[model samples]
Target chain A: MRKLINQKEHFIKDMLDGLKFHDQKISIIEDSIVVRKVKKESGVAIVSGGGSGHEPAHAGYVADGMLDAAVCGEVFTSPTPDKILAAIKAVDNGDGVLLVVKNYAGDVLNFDMAKELAEAEGHNVATVIVRDDIAIDNAEQRRGVAGTVLVHKYAGYLSGHGSNLQQIVEKVENMMESLHSIGMAVHPCLVPTTGEFGFDLEEDEMEIGIGIHGEKGIYREKSETVDKIAGRLLSELLPHNDDNDIILMINGMGGTPDSELLIVTKYVMEALEEKGKTVHKLLVGNYMTALDMQGFSLTIVSHNDELLKSLNAPTESTHY
Target chain B: MRKLINQKEHFIKDMLDGLKFHDQKISIIEDSIVVRKVKKESGVAIVSGGGSGHEPAHAGYVADGMLDAAVCGEVFTSPTPDKILAAIKAVDNGDGVLLVVKNYAGDVLNFDMAKELAEAEGHNVATVIVRDDIAIDNAEQRRGVAGTVLVHKYAGYLSGHGSNLQQIVEKVENMMESLHSIGMAVHPCLVPTTGEFGFDLEEDEMEIGIGIHGEKGIYREKSETVDKIAGRLLSELLPHNDDNDIILMINGMGGTPDSELLIVTKYVMEALEEKGKTVHKLLVGNYMTALDMQGFSLTIVSHNDELLKSLNAPTESTHY
Candidate 1:
């Protein structure tokens, strides 16, 4: 795919610079990490980061009621430990900072190192891993996907309301248990660094249970209509949806057209409703993306009153 | 170019169903028109719509202080006069209604017919065409593109604040005079209805000044770096800047990844700043799109206090 980037090395920096211009409140520290310009000194600061291709995931969510800082790395690559440390330092207030790390080998290892580094610097930091992608049958290895946004907002709302780092961490940990996501891609995205497609598929095929970094799905199948695809994802999401009132997000994998996203949304909502699921809230858009992959993901989490309230809380986060 | 949709005939209806689910305030009337559920009883109402593929264009912009209703049509096809009439009658209050039509033959013809039909019912109504696209050398044939959202917001802001229909129309018409936009597509989008691409392009070629409905641009050229593209667009937008303060929008043509968009956004902002123009406000995202076209467009308008205030006004509009 033809990319709008200057060079592989400069991609993240240029994108962050552009992002800073898009939202004046966002500031770049050490030429990489994105931190909020005005952070509260009396509250727990929320931070999240991982591979950079997920557009609004970590960076764009840095706002008044979302993330305090986002450590963006190169496209589809985890941030370095030092950059993560810089984000931790930049957003750290006296109350402490909470790091929301997605489930990935590199991200987990780097963020863990950053946490210890921050602790060595006399700063209190709490860390929680978002293993929300349920595409894998082995739950322990599920990669974090769009469901991580809920973790940010839920944690941000709690922290903004004076919850300390420990309290925010505990609540988010609980919320993470209910969060689940599954994705299928009609087309794979090109990784800018390698100048190669994430995966290949026939014109009449699609991959299900795909990851945000273009990790191939567990299996491939002939491409089906949206209704069938939505049903396939739905069946894998929950146990037949028995009276589950959930906050559902129909996340577009960057390149999926909005019309198709909505069409998938209509079918998903209808299917959920038919199966006796009460959709407490519905979010449909490219909340988190896989570069410009043409597909959609379903992020479903059973909603409680607090979760619903937090999800509905006003956010200055660019994509929410 | 695989799409996540059912049959073509059910595309718009299914999409609207999903959109209504996305925002509870949005109500689907006649299974085609999208109107706000809770409308004020005493204020001028604003409405805008065209073909259905532009996901958040007219429909998503319907909210408090944005649009009262969005008359959606089929994919890349104008709505029948009756559907437009339904939107006009559905949103009209005793105060009056304003029709914000884009510059397209079918849209203008149908909207004009709808206005006349509404007027014959003794309801006060006015109309304004947004010919913001600067791609066409001839001003008379310019197609309204991403910049129409500005017209919607400005007029919606005015109407919601109790501006009479005539007052709102006059102000918007004045604002329209300064609004300009141009777009380029690195790749053409697939038209679902026709089962074809919007336009044809080679691997190294791109179409400049393309319309939202897949209309080819005025010229084609070998693709350049985003900085060059931004510069190319900037030069064609305004007359060497002249230290003008303006509101700028970097709109994605659906399929462009967010990373590329921010890169584009960064260059555009840098270019404008270097040209000595003050950017009062900058919107960067897929506000209006041509299906899943892989490129972007820039919309610029010199801003005064009211226009800035109107642009910066808080909106419940979905994609703002």
Candidate 2:
């Protein structure tokens, strides 16, 4: 695939620079490549980072009423601890900082190291590892996916409202207890540098519970109707939801239109209603999108009224 | 080409149903297929309508601080006069109503007929046709594209602030006089029922000035760098202006990433800045997108401080 990139290695940096071009309210730290709140931010700062292919996932959500800082790695790869550490320090206020880390192994280790580094510098820090995907064979071993967007939103609410690092971490952990996400892939997206798909699937089939980084999904099947897809996704998530109120997310893999995402949400709502569950909060869009993949995911999180209200809080971001 | 459509004939209705499923405030008229204001619009209600493929074009812009109603038709086809008239009536208050129509042969004719119908009924009405596309051969006969979004935004601001129909029409006409848009397509999009691409281009080439309905562009050549693409698009538009302040819009054609769109916007900014023109506003996203087509369009609209300030006003809509 022909792309408009300067150099394969510089793609991520250039993309980040482009993001900062129009919105002067956002500034990226030179050399370190970390984005921080340009406006004065008080209280605990929430810092999140991940691979860069998901355009609005980690960075676009970093605006007022959301994240304080965001770090980006190369597409589908975790950022080094140094990058994470730089982001943590840039946004660290007197109240300390909280790191919202996803559950991918590379992401977990790197963020954990950064947390230790921040602590060594006398900065009070806490980490919340979001493990929301439910597609793996061992549920305990599944990795994080689209649920990370919710973690950022929920964590941002706590941190933005003056919660300390520890308090914010506790809130995120409580939310994670009932959060589950599952995604499917219609086709593999080509990495710009390689000009080859990250994975491969037949034209008539799709992969379910696929990882964002082109990791193999747990199941492969022929492409089905939106209602059936929603049924399967909800079936996997609703079983463990002990809370009566659920926060549901219908996310696209970047390529689907909002119209289709809403159709997925329609089926999801019907699925929940048939199960006699109350959906307290709902979001359907390309939040936490994969790269040009045509499919949708479902994320269900058990939440209290406070969490529900926080999830729906107003946020100013480029893509939100 | 795998789409989320239920049936070829029911695509528009089903898509609108999906949209209403997400936003409860949107109500679709059954017979007319017109989406109108859920809350009573006290001021002169602003109504807009156009082809259907551009998801969130008209309907997505209708909300608390935006358009009062939007009428829909088949993909890339203008709505019937009956549908447009129904939309105007559904949103019309005692004050009056202003119809914002794009400058296409079909859209202009249909909306004009609707305006006449509404006027014959003794309801105050006015119409403003936006002709902003600069990619066509002759300036006098160019079609409308992304610049229509700016018209909708400004018209929404005026009508929402209680401007009369004549006042709103004057404002819209003035805005249209200073607007120009140009677009390119990397690949052709498929129409659902026929399952055929709207146009054809070589794998290593792109078409400039591609119409919104998958019509042929004026120029076809080997794909160039995004910077060059932006340069070419702005080159055509900048001549129409005598170096005035303008708002810049880099809009995705449904399938491009926000990251890539930002890159395209970067080039557009550089091109405009090189000409010593000031950009008072910048918007980058998938506004007025084709159906999953891989490309983007740039729109420049000259504006005064009033329009600039109004552009930044808080808007609550699904696709703002």
Candidate 3:
């Protein structure tokens, strides 16, 4: 694919510059180099950071009603502990700070070390590891996916309202238990520098439960109608859907058009309706996306009206 | 090439259903079949709409602080007069409504008729036809591209503040003349059901001044580095640059990533800096994307600090 880039290595820094250019409140620390734009007044600041390819996930959620600081790593790479620690310090408002992390081993370890460093500085710190993906053999060790967005929204609401570190951790932990996510890919994504397709899939086939970092999936099958796809995926997600309401997310991997995403959401809603499940809140867009990958994912968060109300609260950002 | 639809013919309606489902206040008028969401407020309301497939373009922008109502047509097809009329009526709040139309023959004619109908209904109405694209053979009849977004921002800003009909019309008309845009595409986009690419280019080629509606472009050349690509495109756009300050938009056609967009913007900024031009405000993203086509366009609106302030105004929407 043709791309408008100066050098592959400079892509992330240039992107960060443009992001900061568009929103001047966003400042990159010269030493640690975390991309943070908004500041919290007096609360337990919430910080989440990860790779760069997912454009709107961590940083885009940094605004008044969402995350306060987002430290970005290289494309699909975890940030160093120093960068994470810097973000924690930047957003710390004397109350405490919460680190929201995905379940990838690198991300978990890095944020954990950063948490220790923050505590060593005499600042109270806690962490919530979101392991919401259900596409793996070990549900306990499943890597986090787009469901992290819901965690960010809820945690931001709590932090914005001045929740203590313990309260924030407990709330996010509750949300983590209620969310399950799964994804599928049509064509693999190509890394910018190497131009290597992250994973392989046949032209007429799709791989379900694929990792955003180009990891292999659990199943490969011929592509079907979106309704069939939704059924197969949600079956694994909603095993006990008899009584819970859900906040449904139909997210593009990156390159999937909004038309296709809406189509997929159509089936997802139908599947929910068929199971007599209530969809209290729904978001369909490229919330967390891969780099030009042709696929999408479904995230179902079982929640009550309170979580739904919190998710619907308004915020300002370039991408919502 | 894979899709989620059961059949091609139902794609638009299904997507509309998904949009309405997530947005409860939004509904389709059965008689006119215009899709719009009502803002439960007593203030003056603004309505805008256009062709579909530019996902998050018109519809995603129709939430708080932007547009009160957005009417969508079929993929790349203009809405009928009745549809536009319905949208105006749906959002009218006695303070009059403004119609923001991209400069295209069909969009102009249809929205004009809608304005007449709205006026006939005792609802004050104003229209601003955006002719901002610099790629046209004739500047007077230039086609509007993504720079209409600036118009949307300013007009929405004024309308949100309850500006009178005469005030809104004058401001939008004055603003339209100062906006100039130009775009290119690496490949043609497929209409959802057809699954066929609109136009084809060699692996190393691009088409400049490509229309958002798939109109033929002015130039086709071998694709080059981001700097060289920016050089060629800026050359075509600079002759019309005639403002002391300007707002710049480096917009993705849909499929391009932020990594590539910043690279494109780097050269674009360099070219502007060489002329000693000042870009007071900049927006870079998929503002008015053309499906999943892998390409981008540049837009600059010559304006004073007032317009710059309005452009920087906070907006709440799915995509900003």
Query: Which candidate should be chosen as best, given DockQ against the real structure?
Result: 1
Which pairs in model 2 have colliding backbones?
A: none
TM-score of chain A of each: 0.97, 0.94, 0.95
Q: Judging by DockQ, tell me the better candidate of 1 and 3.
A: 1
What TM-score does chain A of model 3 get? 0.95
Listed in order, each prediction's TM-score against the native is: 0.97, 0.95, 0.89
- As for candidate 1, its clashing pairs are none
Clashes of each: 0, 0, 3
**Candidate 1: C-alpha lDDT:** 0.87
The residue pairs in collision within model 3 are A26-A37, A253-A290, B26-B37
Write the residue-wise lDDT of candidate 3 on A168-283 in tens digits. 88887987777888888876776776667777777688888887776888888898877788888888778734455677888888778777787778778887888788887788
CAPRI quality band, candidate 2:
medium
lDDT string for model 1 (A129-241, tens) is 98888777787888989999988899989987878788888888887778889999988897878878888978788999998877867779888999998888988888623
Two-chain complex of model 1, DockQ on C-alpha atoms against the true structure: 0.76
Please list the residue runs of candidate 1 whose C-alpha ends up more than 4 Å from where it truly belongs after superposition.
A240-243, B240-243
Worst 10 residues of 2 chain A by lDDT: A31-40
